[model samples]
Target: MKIVNVVKPAIRILPMISKDEFPRMSIEDVQNNYFWGELINNQEGMYNFRKIGMNAPKDSLVLFQFDNIIIASAELLDIEKFVIPKDGKYYGAYRFDINSVKIFEPITLAEINKIDSNITAFSQVKQEINSLFMVEIQDLIKSKQMPILPDELPRQYYGKRTEGAKRQIVVNAYERNYKARQACIEHYGCRCVVCGFDFAKFYGPEFEGKIHVHHVKPLSEINESYEVDPINDLRPVCPNCHLALHSKIDGKVYDIDELKSKIKRLINN
Candidate 1:
């Protein structure tokens, strides 16, 4: 006859007196004294700890369990005064909400080792997870659930081999223009400093994009002496207005300050 070994599960531990419970304690105390558990089941899940409150506030309950045993527990008197330690060890003090507290049986060291092995295998397959996310995003765009723009995709995902195709040139030229446009917009508002056209609604098919940033003296004409003066050389102009500013037949270059003053005069008139 063969004998079968049957292990009896341990009983959960519970608190004996309701008055001994406190609100919250420092993270160091929790780590040193309480049993810890992961907030999530996966490796990416947050880790949390549970403990008996020493000065728990009113209407709050503290509960603890270990396998099949009920550990120490308590009820709070003034929950608001509970302050968790701030040394960055544990997630800060949490309120005693019944829904937030979850009790679970403690796992043995052997069980934890098994979990570690599973996590190691999952980490090796990260590329597959990222691919799934990209496919989901593409589906959203095809379904018209997300707006697709030339520059809207994350930079890392824009030109990679995995990305379907590229149509627009993503250059740092726009950065320089953005700096100049912001200055002009801040000084004169979104209204075109020249033609008085508002570009607030410039998106979509109605407008041919927003306003354009122009180099007041035409970047080519600027003597090497002024190459670094962004504020003095840059100004914002709407597409039509920018063309008008360059309409002079004499090919004379205008200073940015002068162009701004000209627009102000037109607006005033």
Candidate 2:
């Protein structure tokens, strides 16, 4: 398939975490915040570079590298100096649309170097992404099936909450990480763990991969960011069971086993 762009925009590799003896957020935190709104929009951050300068201009493609792995990519929206009053310093901050960010399973630096020999290593400073590698990167981004966060419960359940507030509750309050959902589905087959409902079976082959992954840990209790162990933390649940899991009974949300028991009680009746 044809992959090269006729007039390619500049591409740059940015180290998400600095190794230059300067303290910064950990790689895990960076990865967690990438999809979460904390790192999106026009937020002041040392995302592109730690120092106060910009090499790539607006609309350039950017690869975010952390611990030698390229975890995410986004188009550079704009670059400006962001001040850190606590550090008494200013650094280059990159702003990008959250919707434009595409996350995938980590691609090692060696894999990237294999595609484009120009990149020998990652740096705290930005490295140019060559044309050959850029094509491969573009292909990878396009081909990956990144899943969206589906409403476990219908939007009507969240009455009176604005669209923006609902989204905030999804990420911050529920702590449902879409990447973790991917990992969860990868480990547990896409059949509902509680009800055994298969989307493909009921809805046809076109819906083969469609499933809502539920966070098993108590969602409302999660107030801070933490690394999710997908197998332990998530399970594949069909929309009906997902809604049941989120439903408040008397005053408490039911766990998986509790939801399963409820289903069984109805089945036996």
| Top-TM-score structure, candidate number | 2
Model 1 misses residue 153 by how many Å?
Answer: 21
For residues 45-122, what per-residue lDDT tens digits would candidate 1 score against the true structure? 222323332332243334332322223222222222225643433333333332232322332324322423322221
Top-lDDT structure, candidate number: 2
Query: Candidate 2, residues 1-269: lDDT per residue as tens digits?
Result: 98985555688887654455325755434555444435543342234445556567667888877777787787877776756532544465577655566666677778777778878877777688775566787887666524444333211221122221233322333324455566678899899999999989998996887888777765445544456677887789987788777778899888899888988999999
Residue 50 error for model 2, in Å? 3.0
Report, for every candidate in turn, its global Cα lDDT versus the true structure: 0.35, 0.64
Task: Tell me the TM-score of model 1.
Answer: 0.26
